[model samples]
Target chain A: MAIVSGHPTEKYVRIDRLPHIWCPGCGMGIIFNAFARAIDELGIDPKKIVVVSGIGCSGRASGYWAYDGFHTTHGRPIPFAMGLKLARPDLHVVVISGDGDLLAIGGNHFIHAARRNVDILVILVNNFNYGMTGGQVGPTTPEGTRTTTTPYGNYLESPFNVVWLAAASGAVYVARWTVYHVRNLTESIKTAMQMRGFRVIEVVSTCPTDFGRRNRLPDPLDNLRYLKEHAVYKKNPDPREADIIWGKKFVIGEFVKIEGKETFGDRIRRIIQIAQSRLRKSGSH
Target chain B: MTGEIKPGIYFWSGNDAIAEGAIFAGCRFFAGYPITPSNEVSERLSWRLPQVGGIFVQMEDEIASIAAIIGASWGGLKAMTATSGPGFSLMQENIGLAVMMEVPIVVANIQRGGPSTGLPTMIGMGDVQQARWGTHGPHEIIALSPSTIQEAFDLTIRAFNLAEKFRTPVILLADEGLSHLYERVVVPDPRDVIIVNRKMAKDPRNYLPYKADDDLVPPMAPVGEGFRIQTTGLTHDERGYPAINAEAQNRLIKRLIDKIRKRKHEIIDYEMYKCEDAEIVVVSYGSVARSAKSAVDMAREEKIKVGLLKLKTIWPFPDEVIFEMAKKVKKFIVAEVNEGQITREVERASRGQADVFWVGNYGGRWIYPEEILDKILEVR
Candidate 1:
């Protein structure tokens, strides 16, 4: 038998917690892989990385992650991450969770964290449905899609344009990529990590077990084929035109990047300086 | 003057004292939203926390406030948030999360009236029962009540210490009346004040963050440390990994509840005023204790042989004192600001050993000393 080298991203994974809870062709695995590869490639100390996850199938990614993991209550990861980042500016905090977990139940926190421009990275895996709880229709579920709640079809409400929301909420960096674009997603993770303030990378993911069977793409490979044929990689893609349409082409690329902006931490540091200086001048101990 | 006010007597409101007390207790992180009566706690911390090299943030709402404090607690900081009844209601789910994750955080609930904004500007002891059973599921909580303004400062520090000592969330259940009143609080010397920090896991490589020692508190590993600790709100194993089996659920929940229940004697606290040669013991807590004590004194002047049992710690319910007193005392007068909330508790703990009298009031008002005195005389 021939000897084989260990996996390149093995060091950034929790082998003990492995055989993750994600289903077959679940985009969480690929996203987790790309995240590990990005950290490994950038040579950032894994010890400084912290992963905060909310409830859902996608929330399980924190368990398999090698960094410090906090599996918080559903829709609470952003506020938790905000608290961690504000308390310890040295740590690199990242929120990894599903579309329903982030944009739906945690929607208010998502917007506010971006508005505050807190120093944290958010990886929102856009699977269009609540995968963990048997594929219920969620905030990002496209029109005409079938789900557990919407057995026939969903056409009542318009889906949120995530990139637009992020940009409007003052996110410093926002991007979108299908799970098929592995290299691009990896690069986006690296790019977002290097930036200060709130950075959001939406990975348009495939949920074959829940989302696929109800829609046309029943098989795991069918969802991948749909992505492979229809993904349109663009530069600064308009978020309005980037909404995912079932079996139709969707825009995927970096949509916004604003640099040289002051972060919540930077503003807080100035407050600390002024407060302490005033206290010293007053001779108050 | 953020870190520690010099050890001297200062006249301040209960809210102000609570804020200063948090600073004294080495609480470096504050996250909260503005709510009636409790707003001053967050407002002061916003100005003071940063001065002492700590961080203070006003989150979107009380849910986020509770979540943030819990998160910061895991990040190796003593954190707190103050809220009223409505806000406390919103924080219950994550409060349960703190209990599940075994994170140390302090929640100061300067309670106002409510079952949906019942009395925003008024006093309410309606939340005393809620404080104990607000969070869903089978678990135990630690709650402290302050009757005086000075005790607000003193107990806030004690709240943080107990939180860190047990690695569980502690509640400082102050009434709106006590929260807004101004009185003298003696800020302790910094060196003399004892601050307890969470016991950290000694070994990083073989760290089981959820595995408890003899004390039933698992040593905590700071976030972003090399320990790579897993903290979860789910029913988890000793490694903090989610375990769905009935065995894991039973083992984990049993230990979490037992950790506090087993140490009930150490955790329970109350004060007995002139109960030695008395036949009637007036039982009360929070601001209501003040009224109850005054009523007891009135009875004493009339030679009615009455005394007071003032609760300093509300949860783990000082049941032993009540149980013991039930044996000696001829009758029990349970004076509460709310509608007989703690009255039932007194009856249960007394085990029907004595005749129990209930002095109750609605959330919008207080149970006056005269009313309690009338009840004391009627029962006597």
Candidate 2:
């Protein structure tokens, strides 16, 4: 078996199915590699890993992984993963999805999961467009950007800043990185895996097949360079200021690192303990 | 040994009995929101579940409540949620998913008046059809109705049992009247009770999550068990991949329906009251059956040959029992909180052998014994 270096094992990967579904030079490949490296470096048992994905190209990552996988409906990965984690706390639950899947249809579950402080990792690949369905405008699609859906000079609409939203919604750990920073992306995933509560890492990747073609960068490599030039590290003093016609300025880094409130599991355990004690006392009375 | 049996027992609602039963059944996780008549189930469970090392959460909404319970169930804990008509409607999509994914869950719907927010606290059996066909597509459902507090406890236990055995969602259908009516319930000890756990796949390797054995029910493994299993709502092959072929679809659908349908003999449950030598039989369930039984007694005082068939298991309707009774009885009077709900099932089961009279009340009121007796007298 031809194994990708730093991948845990063949058992966790579908080796024969490689030459992945993503087009050549797509940034999702970079994100996928970083995720594998993070899992390998963490050294957690492959048997204990679960990757949940929603309906999108990013959702296909679950099928490619060797661990327990779930490819659920659009915008439903959070609740589904919540079930998996709650049922088996020992398992490492990670969710992979696109910007639209997490922010649009599944926005409710995402906020609530973070608010409840469930222990799970969410890796959101923000490629700025709905790539799998032929380059439709998404929640994160820059306003006024030309796409199949928004063909005419786009009407202005601000995109959701997912990292800030998650931070505000009580996520214990929140970070944002682009595909150009592969090492940083891997490190963020590792940190998220170690976090005790809801951790979300938003990866701004290039969708050359859809978003790139719409934006006049038909060549996939040119899209990669665009991300590299415009994306800035949290520590960078002065980064290139490339503005999307209708979206917020692209800034990336680990923006939030707050400690989690009591998790749902912990609360449940406490409730059970209290109930047991009360029952004992009531019996005596 | 000759101590007087408690006739007018302690004042406790049907919801109280269900809560107590769930606790007795070793349910440790309860997630629910407060909705009128069904709210008491949550209230009672919130207090009682904790008393036995169980957790109780009052979720923000019914959707999250069901989701949380599913989470708890997968965590290897017996879990449940309670709601009325509107809340139950909200849970339909997830309920369907649970069925397709073969996740064992128990949902208690205390029926209320509604197409939407019809009666918040009024009694109605409008959800009878919803319980059977609310979520889209073809699948077998196990639903139970209770007439008294004792039956409530008993049927709740059965609901959990059927859910675990079939790896499907089980509905405990109690109307608003029964939910709020107080009666005495005797809970059996856990050791004396038979609890069904999900069949765990012994071998992790080559484990197909959706592959059914001879019983047409697949073994379930927890998420952490090193098993690579996929779950979806789409029609799937044995390996859990979405399959489009007609044969694969037929096999999957048949197994889903047959698992519960074929076990009708084991699942069929009812209480027959003076059904023998009766010219008229009153068919009822939940709280309406209580009135039906009284109506039967009153009819007997007048020397009318009236009988009662109280349905405890409502879905996968007791067709054989009904058919047999139809041959013997002159007429079957279907009494329920809603208009013409269970009456249709009675008519179908009767197959035109006997006249089916529906004595239904839709104004958020329980059917009175006199009203049902009068209807029986008219039919007779």
Candidate 3:
């Protein structure tokens, strides 16, 4: 019966909208708190920050955050955030949603946004399965994992290692952490927020109701224990080597961080400047 | 005379006029995926928008294009996107989201043939019905059809103004024929054009994000404006909090529909020609109306009492005008490029008061004046 009320980062929480819909032992609350704490530590103006989320269990985070939050449609947060940032270059836009929402239906947008190096911080909460719906295997679901969609153990050969995909897609900054690594997750979020180009932080979290129960980890806390035991905390592991092979150790760290890169917005401004100059030369303006 | 004409009179295609109109309307953001016919709108804006200190993004797809425009709108920019039939279909669900969120955006669907990517470079008014009901739900939208390249410029500006005024998505439904049709378009001074911006909240604390005023449009506080506004696709109350109940749905949907529905008279624009004492009235829109006008003129020469009614705004139906015309005319010939989309609307409005005949071409071909003149002759 512990409430999210009076939490350290309570100012960022929407007290009116609670109690949240997250299950008793779900790790979304932890990740959500870490995000709030990150924002707090950075002392960023909430007014200048907008949180855009797509549909999922984690998509609900946008509703709980006391900021300019857009709880958008499924698989579309990245594009929505891109538009927001492009419109108001002064505003800090962030996309906080589930792994399935960002990687599956929204995958095209994800890579394109990365390729463009649009300025936005994306916090992907990976729960391995679709939690809002029944236990359904998702894009990040481990091979041989059991779910409602894959009852007799998943036959899918490989699950996407999001960190590698993001890096390969030209993300300026990419990182991965589990909900259990609170300090690491918080610090990563803070860094991503300040970064100018497309930044992604994938937080591997628990889905007790759907994913945890279907697997051997019936209790969500056990899932946390598994993450803590199985994760290898590294500073900058090779993105290609960051895959989670389930039962084997998974590397979690800031995989990529390229500084002094010109963002898509900056490049666009340059394009406009050049085009306007050309127009002036031709006396069209 | 060709070189000495007014500087405003530029030979521009319908699609080109749309882009110029958008810029004149203070549209500072254009995000779209390139599709035929409609692609020119985006291509023109790509360079034009940037020159005006605006942003143009070629998105991954139509859904992203619409999504980006909605985001740009919420970010306090006059935003728009252009697409053809297939792209328009891809944009339906997000368009619904834009409706529910009450985000102001202008989506120009330069319609081509379709059910599934039927014709990429041809004409189709098949999307006339889809323009209204494409997005799943009970929400109403403002969709406009323009006949001339000039109206394309004028109505595209009007579309932005109406979108800003009503805080709803406005569909500038054009066709492949009109999109590519090059004509002399008069671009007005930017100052002469009336541009409406989304009303912003005056006070931070008391500003109910969804609270409609006498005009039925709530003042929007753009994100990053210190309002800390929360907007969602889900049905919400005046405070913009998720309130999923019959009461909330009823109240929210009523305002969403009624804002445009009740103000239909002010929003609806159409042209009627020589309808007095006429036996047959040809109802048409977009490029088809041009042929319709020619047929009406030809019929008049033949002593056939025929008139023309060109619809500028498709949604909100202009029911009163059509019904009024129905009462006066013996029969109405509804001509379009599609089988019989808006014909049903004329029939429904006529309510059996007038005999309705459908003059439609499937796609690819424009409804020739000869065909309409023949229809008028047969009915006469």
Candidate 4:
């Protein structure tokens, strides 16, 4: 297997496809690197894992990973991963997509999957704007942030506090991290991998080419430093306080971790058992 | 439970028969959102699938439903989804994706009136054109239309078989009338039925996931089957690697089209009723075909020479059959529940060899035999 030097998880990546299409100083590579490290450290069989992604910059991560990967349509990786997880409960399905792909157009699928507690790990990379489509303002764009669509500053309402949204929508595990917080992000992924139910780890990533350049943070690292400065770690903060304000304040850390509730697969199996017994009693077959 | 299908005669609706047929064809995964005229398919499979050790999921919406089935098919299971007109419209983009990736999955569109939820409880062949041209792309599709409840059962199974055999998404286009109509259907034993699975790569070491054989269909290696497969809707090369060059694009698109087009003779299916010496051949499909067949019988009794040509496989158009009929017949009456959809195809096939008359309306009801007879009389 071809491996890139220095990265412990380089063996997990498709080195033949490198170098990746990510822009210079993009945060997607960092997040993907962290994911590879987490998966590598966990020592899970690569053949048992499936990586699914939708259309966006972050969606490219599925193609870069050396696994059974699917680059699906825009805004559909959650339900796509839902099918993979539901059909073969033995495989570990992970959805890695962008904010625009997961939250803006695919918001209904996101909340519903969380509500049903489908057993899958979702890593949502929020780059504040739609990076692939030339940085249009998106669902995660802060209240006053300027983008190609909101050139004169956004007059729209505040963006979603996804940590709170995921928690309120019944995600069994919820956490938030930044690209700069590599250790914390990797640790959160590792913990979520061992856990069950709908686990969501929102990574606040950067889009220097589109979001940062328009917002006057021309250097991509400046956006990373901004995230490092603003994010406050809270063990169980109110989801309402988890909003990301541009160049200002935000909240991070694991917010929700409630176990013992039945996952979608567990409930489905139980329903099937009950229905089968009912059929047997009725003697239909 | 894994391979045995209960063989018996039962009075069943088209939706129920389709669900049973899916089970008989080894569809282990069904993901769908309930839509009128097609909901019974999902409801029946919801229980049937579990008993057979399969999975049935009622998704949040139709878009998710199709997307999920594609994922499940990639996960090494034969998968299917059911929907009606509006839901089918929502599933178009993913249908195109399924086409692009050449995923072996079945999508049954029990069509109702549409242009957007026009009629929920009524029937229309309004989706005939949409079934072919709805998805935005340059690609060939196979859509099978069924008239009777029994054909519904058999054709649904054939849809799955054809999808796997051709490595493409096969569509079962049943309308609202046929979906709700009940009839006696004799389901064969699972051992008796012919089930075709995708050809898998024998040597995993040199498995090029998109490399085609002589028949233009590549052996499919499902994800997680140790082939470490990578599949995407984007233009890709034989190795399943994304390639953006003109040569790769031409190669991929050409194979996708040729794989089905070259096998049209095998994929195209239809029933010709008394068209050997008739002057008028009424072209129709779905429920309209039933009434057209009756009208043809009535015309024959009245000594007005007419016949019925019922289309079972609607999409690889069966233009050859139409052309043959056009040469033999003096006039062609295309009877459907939508305005000028199949009629346009009949006219195109006729090539001015015969006069073409269209008997269609958006009344959200099955066109009666009397109305079709009137069109036949007008054509005469």
Candidate 5:
């Protein structure tokens, strides 16, 4: 999350730890590139934004961040961000993680934080499988897909429609975009960062080293070409129709933008007022 | 972070006292889940925390609860959580996170019998060893157990102090009996209570978040303070970047262990009754210490030279005191709600010079002083 505005992007990169773990042709660089462009566009003080990441291929992104960042356990960055945001209302908190870490092992936290309308931005990178773990079957592993865990076609379960889930769980802003749509994804990130309450942007990315090789698309270019060919921008889209069925059309756009709703922080402020008033009446202070 | 606690004497339950103690210790954030014997802690704080302008959140589960407190602590506030065996088990992973990140937070584990949810409403001392070794890694925890209601209050404030002073996750190890027991507690005036705060990192230009000074603890750069807070579960270097190597691991892990070990003198504490001249030391902690203390008194009346060592801090194991006491004692009658958790520690500390005997059960029933007295007399 190199979101340093008014400065060189290298300011945010941990150059000494260079030659990062991400493989060649992985879409993480693109998503990270878009993420940086977004933070750059916002012009917010780089130090003001804290990025939290769950364990995954994308989770490694936090270690590479120039800003204050926490590379947390698998599927735990959301709650960690919630705690941080609640404690320091002045600082902006963001969760940059992956689908397996966010939806599979960490599925409960994702929905709960969204439901509580916690003030944090979640940039969930979807690599279609557990990329860090070598393309294992995961929560977002499409049905009838091959994975390390599922040698045969994965037919035991269906994938989660991340946008729909976020919308259903009461996210104030929800959107999805393939890494190929860098400009649109960057714009979405800019828009979400400017707003309040729980916001989510699911960036559909490629896992060329693992998921891509397991499938027929071994080359990173093939994966990117597939994403570009399948991507379609939907106007006034319903999140339910936002699923990415393999080798088929998939919708990408801002699905929800119902702003001005109360957030977890707002409710706490109100609760503090009511509670302090009662405390004064009780004279217990 | 200054929350007022009027200096006065009042009857309070262990659960209620911990909630107040946390606020007294300047804890401004609490995230907890509802589990038997520990729900009162979260329930009381639902109103209490907000009253002091502190934040309270009943998180999705035990994992989230611990995670939230860790996050809040890094956000530059004293934070805590309360749970039981089942919840504590769920929190073990993130508890490692707190240890690895060296974040200061408190977790109150009101013990209940368990292998896997064995008894939700009953007592067990099973978590003593678990609190120290539950997380996967080289982890050292500061666990304080309270014997009475007053101790429950005082020890909790001590727990927070230890957490802040060391930048470590401190465990307040109480049990179902202590949690439910009600007794008078003297709340000291806020002006008189000792408070330890984070040694904040200044001069963002030269700040190294994970680089320790002679103290073995690095000064923290809290959120919104200009300096970056970069950390990970992986073995890290002084810059707080991931450095997964033998060299980094050797340095980082040694510091993590030594930070508490070298300073164990400041952290280790226990109470002794009639121990100066006694041959048999009945060792116990938490509510079990109550029965053991009574047994010591009863044994002394019968002319048996016995004493009680009620441990307040259980993690560094306080082996220095045990080692010194072992030279003079005939044996140690270790009592616990669990079968033999702390008994092994006693045996190890004594190194076979003194026989170590255990008198306890994991039946979810409270042990009586007579049981411990029997063991003391048997050892005598």
Candidate 6:
């Protein structure tokens, strides 16, 4: 089996499943590599791992893994994963979804899951545009960016900051990382998985084919360079907005961290005890 | 009749009886939101479940409530949720998922007036059609209605049993009147009651979650098991992979519909009250059945031969029973809270043997027995 570099085991990957269903030079491949490396480092039992994905480019990641995988309906991966996790609390439930799938159609489930603080790991791959559906405008589409739906330049609508939204919605762990920072992204996923409650790792990846082609970065390499050079890191400085063609307000880092007192499972168990006691006392038993 | 009358048979609301029945059936998880008459069901469940080591969660909304129940069911618990018409509308998408994925769940819709939150506190059977075709796609549904509190307890147990046996979502269709009105309910011992669990694949390694066997029902392995099962809303093969071929699609669609259709004999349940040697048959379900029964009794006192065919399982409609009744009865009066929902089914089953008359009340009101009798008298 061909393994992604920096993994302890040579047997975990199903290399034959690739070349993956991703466009050439798509950063999702890089993100997938980072995810595999993170899983390897964790050394979780492959049999106990379930990967759930929704409809989008990132949704296909579940098919690439040899573990238990579910390629579910568009924007429904979270609830599907929640079902899996609730059924088998012993298993590790990890959800991988694109910005459109997680933030657009699935926005309601997203906040409720975060509020419940269910024990699941969520990885959001934001590529700014809906790449799988011919580069339509998405929830995270930047202001004044041209896309199929937002032609003649996008109206300057403030887009959702996923990390901030997750943090505010009571996610136990929230982090933001770009594809350029592969190491940081891998570490964030690992940490999110290790956390006991709701964990969200927001990965800002480049959509060279869709977002890039529309914004004059016709070459895939130039799109990658734009992400790497323009995305301002807290530790390092970058060029001013005048020099950058697109993604002028790029920022990435571990944004917020808050540990929950009790997981949803624990709370449910407690509620069951209370309900049972009440029934017995009322002679309804 | 038995010698000693059971005092445990004191008047109890249908919602309370259902909660007790669910407890007896070992339902450990309940996720629901309060909605008018159905709120009593959730309230009773909330207060009773914890005593037996069960979970009751008051969800932010009905959508989340059903979603949470689905999640809890996967956690290896008998789970349920309750709502009224408006709340039931919110649950259609997830309910469809449960049906398509073959998730064993029980949903109780104590119906009220609708189109949009019509009458919150009053009774209506407006959701009778919604119960059958509310969800998108070709699928099978098992819906039961109870006319009295005793039937509420009994049918709730049957609902869970059918859900587990068929590995499909089962709906307990009650109306506002039945949900809130109190009546004597005889609680049976759990030992005497039969409970069915979803069939588990004997060989975990060879398990195909959606593969139908001779019974046309597939064995299921819960999430914690080592078996890897994939569930999706898209048309899928026996292996649960999305299949687009016409043959695969036809086979899956047929299996989904036929699994319930072929098992109609096992699922069909109804009660015939004074139907023998009757000229008129009143076909009804839920609380409307009570009014129909009263009208039948009143008609019999007046020397009119009228019978009541009270439906227990509303879906996979008791066609065989209805067909048999239609063969003998001169006229069939189908009464309900909605305008001619089940009446249409009765007409089809009757096959032109009898004239089907509909008596319906839509604006959050129950169809009175006198009104039904008047309709019967007019037809006579």
lDDT of 2 by residue, B1-380 (tens): 11111223445679887887776666777878788779888887776665555667776577767766765676677888999999999888778777887877889999988878898988889899899999888888889998888888878888888888898899999988888887766655556679777798888788887889899999887777777766666678777766768898798989999999998888889989998889999998888888899999999999999899989999988998999899988899998877687899999989989999999777578889999988977878
Worst 10 residues of 2 chain A by lDDT: A236-245
| Tens-place lDDT digits, model 1, residues A1-285 | 332339898888878776678888888888999999999999999999999999998898888887999999999999998888888889999999989999999999999999999899999999989998999999999999989999779987578889889988999999999899999999999999898999999998999999988887888888888788989998877767777777688899998898989999899899989989988888774
- The better-scoring model by DockQ among 1 and 5 is 1
Best by DockQ: 1
* Model 3 chain B lDDT-worst window of ten: B1-10
TM-score of every prediction relative to native: 0.98, 0.91, 0.98, 0.97, 0.98, 0.91
User: What TM-score, to 2 decimal places, does chain A of model 2 have?
Assistant: 0.90
DockQ of candidates 1 onward, in order?
A: 0.69, 0.44, 0.60, 0.57, 0.66, 0.38
Native-to-model Cα distance after best TM-score fit, residue B223 in candidate 3, in Å: 1.6
Better of 3 and 4 by TM-score: 3
What level of docking quality does candidate 3 show?
A: medium
TM-score of chain A in every predicted structure:
0.96, 0.90, 0.97, 0.96, 0.96, 0.89
Clashes of each: 0, 6, 0, 0, 0, 13
- Clash list (residue pairs), candidate 3: none
Task: Please give the lDDT score at residue B24 for candidate 2.
Answer: 62
**What DockQ does model 2 achieve?**
0.44
Task: Provide the lowest-lDDT 10-residue window in model 1 chain B.
Answer: B1-10
